[model samples]
Target: MKIIAALVTASINKPVSTTIGLLILFMLSAMTVVAEQLPPPSATTEYSKEGADTCLQCHDQDSKFPVLAIFNSPHGNKNTKHGPFSSAGLQCETCHGAAAAHTVKRLRKGQVRAAMISFKTKDVISNDEKNQLCLACHQATTTRHWLGSVHQSNDLACTDCHQIHISDDPILNKAQQLEQCGQCHTKEKVANHSVFSHPLTSGQMGCTDCHSPHDANNNQLLVSDSVNETCYQCHAEKRGPFLWEHEPVTDNCLNCHRPHGSNQAALLTQRAPYLCQNCHNSDGHPSFSYGSDDAQGQQASAFLLGRSCANCHAKIHGSNHPSGYKFQR
Candidate 1:
């Protein structure tokens, strides 16, 4: 480029004594010598000569950024198959994108900013784009259903719960997972805090045990085909091939139970007599009927003294005995 500029200058600075033929030849040579072409501003994205090493210049442990911890993460493990530093031998650029233009000094809207995708910078990458960076290598079984999932639809970023620089992400820890998910799930948190609820707060179970955050096949994000199927995993006794099957039990446990929590005992939606009356006809059985005695043509208390419907119908879920038509075997 310098040679071309010098040649052009010499051609233009020729004195009057110079021959027209010589001047014309110099002008022609200068015209033929095109300046060394450079890519336009839009095409400035190029890989730096040094990859991760370049990024470490500013992100090293001594710096405020402190990215040396990533070396201890799976992403930096060169032996891990198909990982960021695996057979492909990718570096920081593999996830952060090309740094050639980003490393070079630049200004945007009166602010000095990186030209490439630096996740910390505003607008450098959208949530979807940030997810794609991880999906580039993580689009596997667990992630297959991640697309269009509730978390994805809400523009959730993997970094929101995962700490890629560390070996153990908070979401992967049993005790920490509840709190991590609870940050955004305040309603479920309150439900789990209730007296009668799944043992989530105590760490006996995790949200992932019942809900598949990666899946959106159902509104509850249950890991199983249906609500009953999910419950049957732990309450196999309730999943009976009984001689007398309760319709509500077989249909859905939620019909009679609050899955998360409830003020009622055994997570029941309501105290039994009223709850049973929702589906059971009070006049059908004169013994437990709450209907007026005048309508029944008999006199009997409303069973309010010891009126929990499930107290007598102990096998309310189902009954294996032949004579258990009323679920009281």
Candidate 2:
């Protein structure tokens, strides 16, 4: 009886010890699994240019983006035509740089860089760098005056006014360069599209008609810095030392003309006859009786075609004859 009891106790102890060992092994296996599933540490380093070159294998000659076009331009021929790219080591990689990190983030679902290039801030280049970039390869003639222009003072970038690609659209077309200027020149746009404006609608004239892009020593982009000189470029007939000269014409064009675009004929700021009446009296002239905005003053203003003060005083700026008071040319 004693031996049978010893045997039963030994058997029970063996199974109990095995169960305890198995439970310990199960807990340790679960802890190992949890540790393996945790995320990796954050990245602190940047990517290198060599790593970036790998992309050219697929990106070069890509139909989606033809970087080769820019290479064909003056920007790309800096080595011979210009000297900046070779001297400064400013190649295709300089502007774009290593895109590996950005590409990796997109592919592996990792963190992205804060500055993603876009239409508004595509190049990531600084404003001061713009002049340097252009001057590096191109001649300094066209953009030299830009350094002290109103646009520079206001932090306006070169890209803001000019399109690098130069689109074929009306606004981007080279011949219609004024359309680009018109986009931001709200007053010009309004005056040009106004009901009584000049042939601005047909694109017969542009901003460059009266203004120069480069080497205007006086008005930055104007053909002539002096207001009178600029005006005389086209209205050479009016630029005269006649018997009498209009004070506004002698002083400045802005005194009477808007230049950009105006609701009045020939880009005048105010309506006809009234514009004349500002200086001319109302004794017996047809304009005095008919061109005023006042109900009783002038119904003739509405009846006139061009709404031009020239309708009456054809020789507006000056008169040569002894009795040219009416400016009848």
Candidate 3:
């Protein structure tokens, strides 16, 4: 028994290299046991619910990705009636398609999709299909004229100037449309700011309130194209059938007036006397009148400026008098 014990002791104290090899084998066996005990891989897609988590799994800090606030928006709610999960919900995917690729790139390639998926349509598709994405909801609506509008003809994309996901976008709202429009219409802004222009600063009017955004039957997208016809809508009294008539009244209002905000009172295209003298002459004026009103009335300047022709010729439209060829009262 002693001899057997001695032999066992000797074997147990084997070479350092052999002991090290056994220790390595024991560690590998323990590792295998631990690995086998771990939970198995899940088969379900990550963040299929809400999809926000998967998207933010990468988009949390991107400055250009403005829609990230969507997660905190009313549409981001999964529990409320108006939440993204509800019937009236506004899911992130509603405007932007599934963000799977966006998330994948975030985790792997820095969140850049191979190709951009803007809402704009390209030339690759038919005209119908080219606008299919927008027409999906906007068809037969106020924007129905979009098919023939200048923007459509030029292939201008809605996303080029708008962010639809942003419900409170300044440009879309009427009160802020001017500022947005001013970004591209600097000259119009300069004209609007003239000394005698309209009250554009008071926020009572907007670009769309006067001009249509898309195509219109009117010229220059005006609510009414004909110059006089448009003015008549507002100045119905000017469409009079008085016994005396001003010849220019029959012609276009634009012949003497500037409909857009103007630098002159009454929005006149030119100051008064010169404008009136385009046809009239002072052949029947009082004996005191001498120089022509056209050249600032050197001799009768005060009379011409005050009431010379208009005061006495009140019935200038067309006098009913037996001897009034000039319609002078």
- After superposing all C-alphas onto the true structure, candidate 3 shows an RMSD in angstroms of 22.6
Q: Give the TM-score of candidate 3.
A: 0.60
Tens digits of per-residue lDDT for model 3, 1-329? 45445445655969987767666666686788889986422212232355555556545555455566554544455665544545654355444444444444334545544222345454223344435555655555457887777656766665555555454556656667767777767877676776665555566666666666666775466656666666676677777665666677667677767655577766767655555666665366452334554445255555554444555665544565666656675
Residues 172-266 of candidate 2 have per-residue lDDT tens digits of: 34446656776677676667666565455577766666666534666446777687787788778878888977777888878888765666666
User: By summed lDDT, which 10 consecutive residues of candidate 1 come out lowest?
Assistant: 35-44
lDDT of 3: 0.57
Report the number of the highest-lDDT candidate.
1
Against the hidden reference, what TM-scores do the models get? Answer: 0.74, 0.61, 0.60
Whichever of 1 and 3 has more TM-score, that candidate is 1
Give one digit per residue, the lDDT tens place, for model 1 in 75-151. Answer: 88888778777767658778777667777645667776556665553546687788888887887877888878888
Q: All candidates: CA RMSD in angstroms?
A: 13.3, 19.3, 22.6
Off by over 4 Å in 2: 1-66, 77-80, 83-90, 94-125, 165-172, 195-203, 212-221, 283-287, 290-312
